[model samples]
Each structure stands twice: as structure tokens, then as C-alpha cells.
Target: MTPRIHGGTDALGPARWDFSSNANACGPCPLALQAVQQADATRYPDPSYTRLRAALADLHGVEAARVLPAASASEAIQRLTAWRARAGDRRVWTPPHAYGDYAHAASAWGLERVAGPALAQLVWLCDPGSPLGQGESGAAVQAALEGDARTGVLDCAYAPLRLRGASALDPAQRDCVWQLWSPNKALGLTGVRAAYAIAPRGSEAAVAALQALAPSWPIGAHGQALLLAWAQPAVQDWVAASRTTLAAWAQDLRALLARHGWACAPSDTAFGCARPPRPLDATALRARGVKLRDATSFGLQGWWRLSAQQPPALAALDEALQEQEREAVR
Candidate 1:
């Protein structure tokens, strides 16, 4: 969970950006490159995300009708969660430190925002948390869903790194909704603008009921093809490489922070969490030119979420942390 700064004007391009949850800090998937070249500019794409939906359906072992593709996981989760909220479910509870988008979506529906175990109609959680990059069990997730008409949204935004994902929702729970993987993180297609949802099959009416509520078809032709390629077995192998690189970087970040006496939360994946109110830490670090997210804005208890998006960031972290400590004396 990173603080959402209003205008990242000063932090714009020119410098390589590292604070991201996407797979390749570099760019879109190679598979996506092929899709972009192959797109037929002469005609409109399948308005339904049909080919792409079928591909994603096969990946999840579900029928195509049960899936819905969107602009991003942010939009996909918003639509699904908002639909449930509209259907008489009032509250949407999420963890304290969240991706910022979930809370934004919940707020859109006029749902009362309460986070973490307070008993709400809907609970949105990133199983492998965004800040800590740690995942929770499907069984524990299911038990939480049992308490309310709440449809638990397991945001599998970083499932690839943890090797775990959204299998918590079954065919039964009338209140379960799953926010599947955000391709930006798992497949390196951040600009491809693709994400899909896995709803229980046979919920055609429920699905259609949702469809009718939407104003228009999501995902253009080019975006659809990009998602389909990313879902391929061959391309997922390349995604595996990115995960390996991220894991190594995560370890390095933890070590670098420890040298500065920063107690980062033990993480299972790339993003490491830590406290002692890092807002000032980030401000101080930036003064000497090392940019990172300050966790203060997340409303969590004084923690920061650092991204392991680049190898060069390893050296950057060391210099920044050291500078932060020195500035403290002044």
C-alpha cells in the first residue's frame, strides 16, 4: 500500500519509475507485441472480448460465459464489486493497507467503508497483500465469506509470484465474487489494458444481470488479443522469468533496509512492508533523489511499500536509506 500522491508532476518520466506492481518494469509482454502488429486496424474487434474470454476461460477451467474482461483489474473489480453492492449489500470491508483502487471502487457505490474483520456485507482482500506480498489461505478466506452476504474479492494481483491464487470462491456461496489476476503484474502487459473475472458458471442470469447494468462493451480488439496471448502456456513461461528476478530483488531490498536499521515486515514476495512512519523517510530520501512510496497514505499503521521493479534499484535503495539516516541528525 503506497501513498497516493495527487500530482506526481516532479516524479514524472526521464527517471526510470520503480514503484509499480507490474511484471516487467520495462514494458509490455513480447506476446503482446505480436498481438499489436497482428491486429486488423480495418475492422472493429469482437465487442464481447469473445476470443479473449474463451482463452481466459480455458486457463481457469471454466466456461467463457462466466468470465468478463475489462480495461484493468481496477475496472473489473469495480464493476463486479459495485454490482454486488448495488444488489442490497451495503458495506465493503477490506484490509487496512490496500491498493487504493478497491477502496475507491467501494466508495463509488456509496458503501460504508470499514476495513478488516469488522463484519461487513462484502470483504475485499488481496490474498498476497500488496504491501507485504504475503498470501492467505483459501480456507480462511472462505470462512470469512461465510459471515455475511458478502462476496469476498480476492485480488490475485500478484498471485504469480506467490504461486497461489483465487480458488476460494466455489459454485455455492451466493455471496462470493473473485477479482482475478491483474495482468499488469502477472503478464507484463500494463498498457495492454486487460483483466478478467471468474464468476461461477451457471450464473448466466447473474452475469447477464451484471452485463445489462454496464453502459458499453469493455476491451477493444487490440486489448483482447493481448490478453489472449498472455494467457498462453508459452508466454506464461516468460512471466516465470520475471517472477524469479523479482524474488531476488525482494531479498536485496530487505537486506538493504536492514542496514539502515529499518524493520521491514518479513515478506514472501517482492514488496516489503515496514513501519516507523516512512512518509518523512520517503520525503527525505527523495531530497537526495531516491523515490519510493510512503505508506502513511494507506491508513495502515506507519508502513511503507517498496517495489522491486528494477535491478538498479538495489544500489538506489542503499544510497537512499543511508542518506535518510544521515539527514535524521540534521
Candidate 2:
């Protein structure tokens, strides 16, 4: 298995000022948290996920048959790659800089990574993408949708957390591909491992095949409760309101990094990549309770991916940077 590198809690426990993960800083949404905590752990959710599928389908305004739930976004990636490989798909295309899970899944299924979307049997796209938080190019989406034979999966993981700009794929275009959504991050409950995908229009057989390959009860009761709560208007409202706060924090974060001499990259979501004025002592920073996501895994070396934090966390980061500078001078 390809080694997995991710953000959030580590061996030392969660960071005091964690800019490493893109989860909504204002979340663990109260409403969602209540639902999860009250979940009926004694009973099993419908193995077929009838009600859950319908809820997700209704949320997206799609048919119930189109909804396919998974353990998480990474789980969905692996399952899709396996399905494509089983159908003799030999090539996969992913954004130049994207979630490592895409490439790892392709490698596991023995699918060759192609240079362009048109040359591949499977294509992956992310909007308000991770690390950089940029939207996928329109041309890439078009290429993925050009052929009926090709399978396209658009990662909508960061869509709810988007702080600026609109999606590259509009409603009609999104219906043309698999829309993979993991709402945990937006709900501020990333600990809940649940995700679902909306299959492209008229891809029932493909959906069924992937579903058959899945193990029983891909999501547990707590996950089911979380997904159910995600469809609630109150929860949606909370998420929307949080975005306003997050946007302001993102702006403040950019300014903070700029003041410290770091060059930040533009991002539509709350998280973005930035280059420190000088090499950072990451271990030292961690020891001081600060953690940042290195962008090297996303193929961007010398840049760190950071998410907007609350003022207190931001202040802590400022202190950490100043300390680093003082140490360098000494």
C-alpha cells in the first residue's frame, strides 16, 4: 500500500493551533454533534441504505438509484478505481496537484496515470481543491465529460467550505459525472467517516457494480446519523453562516502570513498554500503546538498548506513564527 500522509491529530494528539486540516474551524456543528451523540448504536442501519440513499438523492435533486454511499472520500476513491480496473480501464488521469488518494488508488488497481484526461478511461477532478484550494480548470472537466465510455469522478469535498469563487462545474455539468461529497469537514465532524457519490445520469449498472464490490454496512449508525443531519435545513443554515465567518478569517490569515513575509497562493476555500520567507523548523513548530500541512505530498514543495483558524490559534501561530525568527537570528 502507498503510505498515506494526512493532517489533523497525530501521535502527539491534536495540535493547539492546527492549520494542517481544512475542516471548518467554526465546526463540530452543534446540531450535527447532537445527532451523532444520540445515534442508536444498538441497531444496524438498513444494509441496502434505502432511506439514506433517498435522503442524499433528494439533497442533490437526483434519483435515489444514483446515490452510492461509502466509508469516506478515500474509500470511494479506492472503490471507483477498483471498478474501473475490473472493467479493463488501463489509464487514469488526475489533476497535476491533487489528493494523493487518487494516485494511490490508481496505482493499487494497476491503472497507468496518463498525462491528459482525454487519454484516460477514468478521470478525477476536484473543485475548490485541497492544498491549493483552487477550482479545477473548465477544459479538464470538458475533457472528462467528452466521452460516454470514460468514467469521471468530481471530488466535491471542499465545495461546502468554499470561501470565494464559484464551482467550475455548474449543475448540468455536475450531473454528467460522479459527484463525490464528504460533508464531515464542512460540518466540523471529520471524525465521522461517511461519504456518498451521485452517479452520472444513466450509469445504473456501473453504480450497481461498485455497490456489489462494497462490504456490508459501509457506514455505521453514527455515520448514518451524521449524514441524515447533514440534510437538515438547520444544519445547512449553520454551515452557510459559518462560511461568512470563515471568509473573514481567511482574509485575516492571508494578511497575517503576508505580514510575516510568507507569499500566499490564492484559494477559493478557507485553506491555501503559502511559502515561508525561509525554511521552517516544522518539528520545533510542532513542539510549540503548531502544525501545518506541507504541500510536498501535493507535488508543491517549499509551500505549506494552511487553513484559517480562530483568532487565538492565529495569534499562537504568529508567536511561533516570531520565535522561529528569533532562534534563526541567535
lDDT of 2 by residue, 32-111 (tens): 99999999999999999999998888888899999999999999999999998998899999999899999999989899
> Poorest 10 consecutive residues of model 1 by lDDT?
1-10
What is candidate 1's lDDT per residue for 1-330, written digit by digit as tens?
A: 223442122544423445534355534567767876697767777777677778898987778888866677877767876788779887777776667777777777887776454467777767677666666646547655675355666777677666324434445542255656666666555556667777654566777876776656576666677777778887777777766766676677677767666788766666757654243555555555556665655665566677665667667767666666677778
After superposing candidate 2 on the true structure, give the runs of residues whose Cα lies further than 4 Å from its correct spot: none
**How high is the CA lDDT of each candidate model?**
0.65, 0.93
Displacement of the residue 279 alpha carbon in candidate 2, Å:
0.2
